[model samples]
Target: MEGLEQWKIQAEQWSQQALQYIHQIPPNQLYAALAVLLFPIIFIFFVRLFKRTKSNTIILSGLSGSGKTVLFYQLRDGSSHQGTVTSMEPNEGTFVLHSEETKNGKKKPIHLVDVPGHSRLRPKLEEFLPQAAGVIFVVDALEFLPNCRAASEYLYDLLTNASVVKKKIPVLLLCNKTDKVTAHTKEFIRKQLEKEIDKLRASRSAISAADISSDFTLGVPGEAFSFTQCPNKVTVAEASGLTGEIFQVEQFIREHVKP
Candidate 1:
């Protein structure tokens, strides 16, 4: 008890000395000292906060029968899980890539959301776009011509979305069902979509400024509509969700989500 009392007394003396020393310093110097000491603490706090809040979500979207659901399941299960019916609601999950489950240590989990391709349910995409690390627009490679216009329209909307455009989110035009002999090549699909989008651009531009519903316009005016003209990074790749050939999709995810 006596030793405790002495320790308390010594602490009080030290506190008093600290106060005296602080009082002896000039006001400006003391303020500068406080700032110097606090800056690193504040900086570290924000850095940690950002890292904690950074999203690992990847959004999968496309027209119905585009194989998004198949891809989603394949990523999570490493298998197509047999026949996959059309998804009516968003199929959401957080998991490590099934392919990565077998190899190596400490694989990061991905937050993947497969938004329904039906037009009615596509609105749900806006909810996740703000937090998405990247977007994969799955296209039906086998039926590319029949759906090219609709796919281009959907892709245009995504490219112009406020969140997607503002964040400069990277987009992957994934041509699904590439394993099929009739599947269109990525180069062909890309050129066709660009042509379709170019036509849409001309039509949409005729509308008055007040009537433009899209948050941003696509491509540069008076120039041919090309993926390169987009403010964000747009890329095209081929994949077969059913055949479990999705290395490109996995690469895109890791590029944005860091594992």
Candidate 2:
């Protein structure tokens, strides 16, 4: 009982000292000091209360004949925009997906950009990476073998880009043109790409770090390269952009870009 009473007296004395010190300061100075101390607390509270908004941009990219433009039109207009030629420039638009147009509620529009596959036009992809919610690399499934190396190299570069790796942006390896009976399966295309990438990874890692242009590296050091090994979410899906059978593509967009 005596110890408890002594502790209470000490607490009261500290409180009195604090009150005395606060009173001694002039009103203006006191207010300034209080404001300085409270500013950061108030700022932090507001920051937590209002979280950053997610980006609604999605990038569609791939080789020239991979049907990226077709997919873009299909998503926007539900038609193949007949007589579409190779896009020398990016085809971009912000709109609600055609598939969702019939839905009961309103849908959030996505800003979709299809960066052309031409070698000279490839650098434009960097301009959009910062705001991209996800990236879709369309592969020509019907012509997978002949273009596997080129596709793998492009994909390796994309997977190693500084923005992509640092942001951990999701990537969809879309094997397009699955409507044809002869079109390769997504699994086969995935495995071949992995094998090709594994070889590329080995050769690239042999170069001196100073000479390496890619901002990041891919796969585990000692194991074969696999999509699962990517730090970012890498997934494979089949689609036929020419036939408007792009349910998987729509699903990927909806997964990253909220309604």
List the global CA lDDT of all models: 0.93, 0.95
What tens-digit string does per-residue lDDT give for candidate 1 at 146-246? 99999999998999999999999999999999999989999999999999999988998899989977899988888899999999999999999889999
| Model 1 per-residue lDDT at 190 | 97
RMSD (CA, angstroms), candidate 1: 6.6
lDDT of 1 at 50: 84
Model 2 TM-score (2 dp)? 0.84
The global Cα lDDT (0 to 1) of model 1 is: 0.93
* Index of the highest-TM-score prediction: 1
Task: Highest lDDT: give the candidate number.
Answer: 2
In the predicted model 1, the residue pairs found to clash are none
User: Which tens-of-lDDT digit does each residue in 114-175 have in candidate 2?
Assistant: 99999899999999999999999999999989999999999999999999999999999999
